[model samples]
Target chain A: MTENRRYRLTAIAVTLPTLMSATAFEAGASEPGLPQLDIATWPSQLFWLVVLFGVGYLVMAKMVTPRIGAVLEKRRQTLDGDLEKARTASSDAAKTRAEYESDLEKARNNAAEFAKQAAMEATKKAEAADAKVARKLADKVASAEAALAKAKTEALANLNDVAAEAAIDAVAALAGIKTTSSQASKTASSIATKLAKQGAN
Target chain B: MSNSEGMHSPVAQFEIKPLVELSLGGYDVSFTNSSLFMLLAIGVSSIFLISAMRRADMVPGRMQGMAEMIYEFVAEMVRSNVGSEGRPYFPFIFTLFVFLLFGNMLGLIPYSYTFTSQIIVTFAMAAFVFVGVTIIALYKHGLHFFSFFVPAGAPKVLIPFLIVIEVISYFVRPVSLSVRLFANMLAGHTMLKVFAGLAVMISGAGGLAMAGSLLPFVALIGLTGLEVLVAALQAYVFTILTCMYLNDALHLH
Candidate 1:
C-alpha cells in the first residue's frame, strides 16, 4: 500500500511540471484578448493553478496532516492510559479493604475466646474459697459438742454422791435407826443408775 | 484627467495588465496581478499551515486551533460524504478548499483581484477535480465504472433514457461547479462595485446630491458585508460539491 501511494504521488508530481509547461506553451502562442474570456490566459491560469495546488497539496499531505493526526492520537492514548491506571488503583483499594475487614473479624474472635477462659478461671477460684470456709465452721461445731457431753457426765456423778449423804441423814433423824455408810451409798447408786437408764430410753 | 478617470471604470478592475511578460516557443506566459494574488493565496495558505503546526502541541493555541478547525471541517465533509476510501484525496481537497477560501476573502479587500471570479480559473479547478475523480473511478473500478450511469432498480423501459440523462449530468459537473463559484463571486463583486459607483456618482454632484447619496452609501455598505458572506459561502459550497463528486466517483451510487 505504501509503495502504491508513493508511486502515485511520484506520478502526480512528475505530471504537474509537464502540465504546466504544456499550458505555458499554449499561452505563448495565443493572442491577448478579453482577460477572462480570452483563450490566451487560460493556459497560464491553468499552469499556475497546477503549480500552486501541487505546492499546497505537498505541504498538506507531507507536513500539516500528519502532525495534527499525531496530536489527536497522543491525546487518545493518554486518556486510555489514565483510565487504566484509575481502574487498577480502585481494584487495589478494594483488595486492601477486604484484607482489613478479615483482620478485624479475626481479632474480635480472639478477644471473645480470651474473655470466656478468664471467666471460667474466676468461677473455679470462688468455689474453692467457699468450700474451705464451710469446713472450718463444721470443725468448730463438732469440738463444742464434745466438750458439752464431757461436762454432763461429770455433773451426774457428783449429784449421785451428794444424794447418798442426804438420804442417810434423813433416815437417822426420822426412824432412830442408823444405816451403814456403804449400804446408803449402794442404795443411792442404784437410784442414780435407774434415773440414768430412764433418761437414755 | 482622462487617464485618471480611465482608472475608475468598473470593468477596468478585471483587466490583466502583465507584470512580467515572458515567452517560451510561441507562448505568452506573462505573470500578472492574477498570478500575483494566486501566489499570495498559496504563500498565505502555506505560512498559515506551517506556523500553525510548527508548535504541534497536544494543546493548540489560537492559530493552531483555527487551522485544526478548518482541517477537521473538510475532513468530516470528506469522511461523511466520501467515506474512508477518500482518505488519500484529503490533501488535495484540503488544499483546494484553503486556496479558494483565501482567494475569495482576499478579493474582498480593496484593490485586490479575485482570481476565483474568473471563469477560466474556476473552470480549471473544476475540470481538474472532475477529471481526477473520473480517473480514480476508472482506475479503481476499471471499465465497470461506466455502469455508474445506469440507475439501480429502474424499469427496463426507462433505463436508456435515464442513462442518457445521467451521462449528461455527469459531464455537466465541471461546468456547473465552475459556473457556480464564478458566477457568485463575479455577480457579488460586480454588485458591490455598482452600488459603490452609484454612491460615488451621487455624492460627486455636491449640495442636495450628497444628502441623496446616503441611501446608496448605506446600501453599498450592506452589500459589501453580504458579499463577504457570499464569498465565504461560495467557497464552502464549491468544496463540499467537490467532495460529493469524489464520493459519487468512489462509491458509484
Candidate 2:
C-alpha cells in the first residue's frame, strides 16, 4: 500500500516538471514557428506533476524496487541463518559438555562407593575367620587338660592298691613258719610288730 | 575579448537563472541543454552498466570487469555500513552515484550546461533523497519513527527542545546536501574558466606578459585534474550519504 502511494507521488513529481516546462515554453510566445501549448496554469502544472509522479512511482515500485529488495532479502536471510546455526551449535556443545561432566561425576562416585563396600566386606570376613580358629584352639586345650587330670587320678589309685598287696603278702609268709598257736601268735605278733616298726622306721 | 568583460569571468558565468519561466500552463514543454545533459548522463550510465552486465562471465571482459567492479564496490559499501540488511539499497545507491558522477564530468565539456551547478536541480535531487529516506523510515517503523529524534540516553528534561532541534536538522538536510555538491562543482569550474580566461588575456598582451600567461595555463591544467578528482569525490560523498540515510531509516539511529 505504501509502495503504491510512492508510485503515485513519483509520477506526479515527474509530470509536474513536464507541465512547468510546457508553461515556460508557452510564455516564450514571441518566437515564431514555435510549437504552442493550449493551456497554461499553475493548477495544470500541479496536476501534471501529480500524474508524472504517480506513473514514475508505480514503475519503480513494481519493477525496480522489487528486484533490489529480493537481493537484499536474500542477504539478510543468509545472515540470520548463520546466526541461528551458531546459536544451536553452541547450545548443543554446552549440553554435551554438561552430560559428559555429570557422567564422569557419577562414575567417580560409583568407584568410591564400590571400594568402601569391598573393604567393609573384607574386614568382616577376616574377623569371622579369626574367631573360628580361636574357638578350635580353646576346645583342643580343654580336652588335653582333662586327659592329664584323668592320668594323674589313675596313677594315685594304682599306687594305693600295690602297697596294700605287698603288705598282705608279707603277713602270709610270716604265718607259714608255724608253732603253738600262742607261740605262733605271739611270734607272729612280734614279727608283725617288728615289721611294723621297721616299716615305720 | 577584453579583460574588462566580467561575464567571461569563470565565477560570474555560474550565476543561475531558471531556464523555464515559471507559469501556470503552456504548450512549450521541451528539453533545455541542462535537461538534455541530465538525460544524457542517466542514459550513458544505464547503457554502459546494463550492456557491460549482459555477458557476465567468471573471467569478465573489460566492460564486464568494470561493471563488476562497480557492483562489488557498492555492494561492499552497503554491506559494511548498512550491513547485509542494507543490501537491497545497493542498486539505487549505485545508480545514483554513476548518474551524478557522469553528469558532473559531462558538464565539463565545452558549451555543456552544468546541471549540478544550478541550485534548483541539485536541491531537487537532494529533496528526492530526503523524501525517499523518510518514506523508508516510516515504512519500517510506522508512527514510532518519530522516536528517532529523542535519542536513547538523552536527559528527559531536554526531550522537547531536542526534538525541535532534530526536526529542524532533518528539514535542513536537503539544503545542506544540495549546496555541498552545487558549491563544489560551481567553485571548481568557475576557477578553471577564470584562470583560462586570464591566460587568453595575458597572451594577447604579448612580450613578457605572454610568459606570465603560461602560469595561468599551467594552473588551469592542474586545476582541471583537481576538478576531476573533486568530481569523483563528490559523487562518492553523495552515494555514501544516501547509504547513511538509508541505514538510519533501517536501524533508526
Query: Highest DockQ among the candidates is held by which one?
Result: 1
The numbered model that scores best in TM-score is 1
Q: Where's the lowest-lDDT run of ten residues in candidate 1 chain A?
A: A25-34
Query: Least lDDT summed over 10 consecutive residues: which range in candidate 2 chain B?
Result: B1-10
The lDDT, on a scale of 0 to 1, for candidate 2 is 0.66
lDDT of 1 by residue, B1-253 (tens): 1133222444445656668886656666678788888889888988898798788777789998888888889889899999999898888888888899999999999999999977778988899899999998998889899999999999999999999999999999998898789777766776676677778778888998799889988998898899889888888999999999998888888
Model 2 misplaced stretches (Cα beyond 4 Å): A1-201, B1-7, B11-24
Clashing pairs in 1: A27-B28, A28-B26, A28-B27, A28-B28, A29-B26, A29-B27
Candidate 2 per-residue C-alpha lDDT over B1-253 given as tens digits, one digit per residue, 9 for 90 to 100: 1134333434334432335543334443333455556667766666676576555444568986676666667777788778878866666676677667888888877667666665556666688889999999999999999998886788999989999999999888887787788777766776787788788888988898899999999999899899989888888888788888889989998
